[model samples]
Target: MFRNNNLSVCWRLVRREFRFHKGRNLMAVLSVALTMALFTVLSVIIQSLVGSVRDYCIHDMHATEEMYRQFLVSQLPELFPYFLSFIPVFVCGFLIIYNIFRIGVDADIRFYGKLITLGMTPRQVRVIWYGLALAVCGLGIPAGAALGIGGAVVFEHEILNFSKIPIGMIVSLKAIAAAGVLSLLTVFVSSFRPARITAGISPALAVRYMELSGFERKKEKNKFFPISIGTGNQVGEDDRKKRITPRRMAVYHLARSKRRTAVVIASLSLAFILLSCVYVQYISADHDIYLHFITFSDYTLSVEGAGADGANISRDLEPSLIRQVEALPGVSRKGALYKQEEWLDLGEHVYSRLTNYFESEGGWRLREMESDVYWTKAYENMRKNHTCIGMVYGIDSSYTELLARPEQLIDGTFDAELFAFGAYAIAEGVEGGGGQPNYQVGEQVEIGGRTFEIMALSIAPAYLRADNDSAESAFSLGLFIPEKSFRQLYPQRGIRELHLNVEEEERARVDRWLADYQNTKDPFLDIRSREALKETFDQQIRSGAAVGALMALTFGVIGIFNLANTLIAGLLSRSQEFAACLKLGMSDRQLLYMMIWEGVCEIGLVLAVVYPLALLAAGPGMYLYLTKVSNLWAYQYRFSIWPLLICTPIMLVAAAGIPFLCYRIIKRQSDTSMDPERPGAWS
Candidate 1:
């Protein structure tokens, strides 16, 4: 019998809800559609952009195979981990939309009493209401999901060929599924039981009690802001006298005997948090990739030129006009390094060997050279050790004074004696053919078929030379060689690339001039500034973030707006309660003020709770996600105080404003012009 009653009640509740606000339900559904559509479209656009950029980064940029390896290794840890970070996002989204749904719940109760008085059983009513909520949620979720996924696919495949990537298909599918499931869950959870509880309330009590309504709450204030002729005043003077303070009054109004404002507030807070999280993540990632531009101290420029083989040369630079053009630039020292295309048969097999030029004592060598401006002691040691193979570099012996501590030498080497020989010297990372103790300062090593004694053994950058497994890695390794000796090893290979450190302010200007130089002389050369390259990278990251946020925003807005509509509906239902307050002298201003205050309080409380919760959930989740999925060492956590400070006030205003507007509309519709003498006409 209980089961049958519950089932009957559930159906009745659904029918009543549908009957009460047909248009509202339709509008809510439409809003959901729009939100889902926008979200889907945005996701595809961003993903495509990211895909495009990723290809560029990997294939075009030539960032070294080791870098690629490290990238993959860093991400390998996340291979098996679920993309659980999205869970918090969904939860937060639900919270926001749930508040909107509560409004509907409130309205359901106001009318529930009317239905109960007619004949509905409490048990039956409860079941029916819960059922309606579930039904609506179920329908809404699939609809929203379909819209979201459909939009995304259209854009990804039709507009942007980014869907070509294997992962792109998977991502698109996941996004659609997630959006659909979350939307359904949020509505179902929010709608369930609201109407049923209202039905269970004592019908006698509901019928006898004077409920609150927008017009009834403003009777006294009507004297000042007179109610419309058709609107009826319901409250008496005594009710208004009980509440005076704006803040307290507002609290009472939202809290009322049945508080839905609290629920609404909770919803808004959740939505805000989700939006903020997505925005922050996206913005931060974009900034991270472009941080080089924001904080760059040197004017770095990448000069691209071609070589006959793997090497580059100013001589081979084309119409020969480029050299003259380059010389004409805002005068500054410019040198180039070219690794001529060479095939070396190491006996076993031929491996593509790309040997970059480093200036050494005799000439050039097949090693990497770095101008060490930090250590003089180690610089001196390298000078004594001539044959430190893999690496050769230039150094300013004077800076050795800065690295005076022995610990510096033990760790990074403070010796400057290494720099004097050949205007360059080998630091470390090579040994004799067989396998000698890893070459140290006092040891001898062979590199490029030349044997030289190590003046000093010290660690200075390029620590390890290897690759790891990962799609995203940034690692570099090579032997350090001095500048003067660079000519001896690769005297034949021309300069292919030049790394220039210019003044930060002059970087752009310098790049323009260099580009102009390259264009005039050779069509084959490509000059890229760090700024431009970084911009491309940043754009890609921004696209990915936008995609995630779009999904969140879709369900979030649908939930919130519907919640707002429902809140208003419920507020209008309590016409009798509001009538008492109105007659008691509560002015229109006071009532409106109270309503706004109620909204503010509710939203504030919810935010207070949710902010901490979101942080707790998202913080560690993001850390683990990034650490496992990317080559990044650790996920840096940051909270921008400004966003919260700025958004809080805005959200408060919006929350209050929505209810106030609804109250006015309802008040205008009520018949207030009827004289007091006609009290029993409808009563």
Candidate 2:
């Protein structure tokens, strides 16, 4: 009977609060909906992209079907970005929900005091508040989930409207469930603090609840001082001046409700900080990073891998085709890395290390190395006389530029003129943890039974270098020498690969031309271009931007919504105080000034808090993007304040406008309007 009575009272109290505070409850529902919707939309989009990554790992990275499942588990970098978004989501959600609940608690202090007088326990009060959040989540989550799935489809087509990257919408039950769980957790966490405040209120203190102020501040007595520490100074009432103004009152209101103001300020600051961080990340993710790191040219045509039928660059990539490509209407500059496979006896020590690398790294792939006859022959040779098979790529001055580029250089020097006169170099793998160089700079190594001076140790970027096993390993011991010398080495051979840049407008024409030529004349020729690679990189950047935009939109709107909620809560809770001020000669315009000052105060605190913290977060955020997450070696950390600057003005306008407008609406609805200039108003 006792338990039933407590339950009945809790339900009635919860229902009354819900009915009385319709606007506040409405805002709460919207906030919860927005939070879940952002989470759902982001999850769907992220899952779709992760699917794309899985396909790439399976088809491109050559991970087998069984290994693919294990690969996602072992290498989950694909999920890191999606998980990273939770920080802002939870933060924004907590602050907004917490501020709303705190205001509700302040407003209900008297009602709670009466409930305590009726023998209700603090535990029951806390449960009431928790139930309050539960009520709103019921209405919010489903609506948000449905809109979120729709948003996923809309955002997909939106991305395709601007970018070449295909982003298909994927609606995952797992993702929706996750969003729901997180949304509930956010509410539960946010409600805990406010519930505690509700539970801690003293019935006696609550009975005297007056202003927005919760706790009683200790009064400090004023002390008077005389000039020059002399007792002869006399206190005189020369003039009586009223010092307290609307601006001062606004400050007092904010100071009294410190917790509510702090939550509001923190929500706004975090939104700005997160927006700036995403902007920093987007800036760091430049497509040029990939372009410069790969080849820097617009297009590449390679026949190096067409050795499947024993047909190679020497046999199929004719010189006449190179001339015709160059003579095309839009061809700018041309470059090529001509290649012919050669084996070198780089001594016993180097051969031993190469053997270890092949065994350790090769695992199972090298044993099934039947890609072509050339690799098989090379592997067989390496097993025999400690010989390592590698390509002798003859590069012109243009290809030599790749050799000496700061990003590509491992060691040594290359002068195109010197290289033209038979200066040769050993090519090392740029990124791998392979063993030390087989031949040092300036050291002489024999290839083709001919000795040549090693000019530099550099990695050949792009398609010229291929993974090697016990066989034709371009990664382990490739050779680069001048083109003229390479012609002498293999006079009748054709160019290995042709790399060229074309005018931006004529790329389509050139692409069509290359496609037709490859389909008709030489079907085995490999064609790659900067534009194709660019779409991949751009997709990464644009996808992130779209996701970031969704999150930013959520945070931005919620922060403002939270601010409005807090302000209205304050205004409504302290209506008696404002009425007293009006009765004491405070004018309508003065009330407007007070609210404007409150808005200014909020924006001021946000600016003071946001920029310094954003700098700290953005630096680490930028570092993680460049060094830890991204594959772009050319992206350098460069800090810019433009993102913050762009976001600040808008925040300022919203902050100031919300309070000022809120006051006008609240004032207009008043049943009785007091005139400050009325006789005896001061009394």
Candidate 3:
């Protein structure tokens, strides 16, 4: 009997609310729509991008597979420590997306209180509005996701292709199911706050703002226009000229509900802004990086080889094999450069406990000695003239361009004179030194147990790695010499490694072409291409993205709940205004129509402000990061429409439904509000 009476009372009160504040109820509904639309537009875009990140990075790159199988095996101890660095980015992304969702819900709560004042019982009012909000939110989320995902997917695919690596992507049904259940769960939880607020308010309070009853705050009237007159206006009708224009009304209403508006817009705007910024930055960075890599001095395919210890590949393999690799498709300028390690012997007093002294009486050190090796540049710090010896590479004139060291000239030019006398291109600061000053390009120096003219100084552009500790770092600090100089200096010493450059685009093809040569008599040759190296690099990026996305989703849940709560609370607050209309003889159907209209208006307003800005902000940055910075060669940044088209309706309906349902419940319980005193003091 109690339950039945409560139901009857609730219906009666909702009917009364419908009668009293029809126009305001309409506005309240629109508020739900607006917020939902905003939520939908932003969330879809962000979620889609995030989803693409997961798909392309984890599935396409197979980052985990490569890490465990290849790179991590040799450095297991360092691997675990390195994996710990990706925590912050994920945490931040989740916070941003979740906050945007919350803002949408908060706007609903802001208008809910007014609906309560229209005679609708709190319980009934909550049901109607909560339903409205849910419907709008439901429509918006998917649309936004679609829009964001569409563009992201295309770019992601391009990135994968450009990297020339494949990944094994698995679609986890469990994860999808979990996402679905969780989203529904969020909707359920978000609806409760407004329900609680509605149930707690008294019927009397529902007739007007019970929360503000004690305050008699006076608002200053705007009188910006003193004597404005229109063609149809008369002096006697001056007071009526204070009508609010729709745009002004919207702004005025939002301002008047400053606290709620601030909560909603600020949260939503932040989400939109953050997602846009991150997407833009990441894509832009990638694009920039790729463009830079393509700008190398030579459109040359790089050949990296590991040879039998102390064996020179160029000397071991027939020149015919080198020609074979160079003949591959897109093979452009082809040349071989020497790479090898050599022991250093320092003369007596010049070498302290830190240095090992070796017998330098022989013109050359034996191959395979493990004496400590140091760059010539390090000698300056020793402050003493010391006889030290390390191996040198002999190179042809073309080798200078291959090493990207055309600037290694000091006193002499790179002309035939320097190339003829076995000219050596030592590093910038190293030359013959005793009590004498450092040698210039014109002088001859005793290096690698040979006398060679300092024909040029190698001022090459050194390579850099993400972390300064990569292989290129070591190479940057090494010395260079012409090929003739090495043979003249150490006629008996052997070559160590040989590097070949092919057409830049044919690095892989050249590698394949060399496969036959590698299989034949030459067990000492090991050829590697830049494409393979790039594959490894791409894998690293995908691994990072995977780690980042997981963490982002975790924190995003909290934000989503907070934002949803805020929105529900605001929408429920409008119940009083809805109830007032019902009491004043407005039809239930009419009230519903007005509420629907309001939801549409509010959603439209939010979309109007958010979508384009989100697009504008995210576009250039995303293009730059993906194509240039990340060096995702295949990525193309384009404005995507799918997320917008898809998420818009879902969010709008979810946003609209939350409040509509709450209001309907109030209508069902319209009678409960008839006896104002019985409903308690706040009412």
Best by TM-score: 2
True-vs-predicted CA distance for residue 142, candidate 1, Å:
8.0
> What are the runs in model 3 whose C-alpha is more than 4 Å off?
1-217, 220-253, 285-333, 340-391, 402-421, 428-444, 453-477, 490-526, 533-564, 582-683
Best by lDDT: 2
Ranking by TM-score: 2, 1, 3
Report how far residue 126 has shifted in candidate 3, in Å. 26
Candidate 3 lDDT, tens digit per residue, 489-510? 5556443333455555665555
Question: What TM-score fits each model?
Answer: 0.60, 0.80, 0.47
Answer with 2 or 3, whichever has the higher lDDT.
2
Candidate 1 vs candidate 2, TM-score winner: 2
Model 1 quality (TM-score): 0.60
Task: Assess each prediction's global lDDT (C-alpha) against the native.
Answer: 0.46, 0.71, 0.43
Better TM-score candidate (1, 3): 1
**lDDT agreement of model 3 with the native:** 0.43
Q: What lDDT tens digits, residue by residue, belong to model 1 across residues 1-683?
A: 22234364557657776667775666545544454454345444444444444453355443345544444444444432224434444454444444444455554554667766666677666666556555555555567667756666654533333122333533466555545555555555555545444655776656544434545555534332233322445646754444246576555555453444444445455555656565555544644434432322222223344333322223223424435444543534343332222111121110111111122333222111111111222223333442112322322232223223242233234335554464333333332132122334443444444555545444432111221111111111233344345556666544333334465666667767767756774555555455665665555555455555554555455445645654566556655655556655555566667666766676666568756756654565455555464554212444443445666676567678877886676466544642345433212
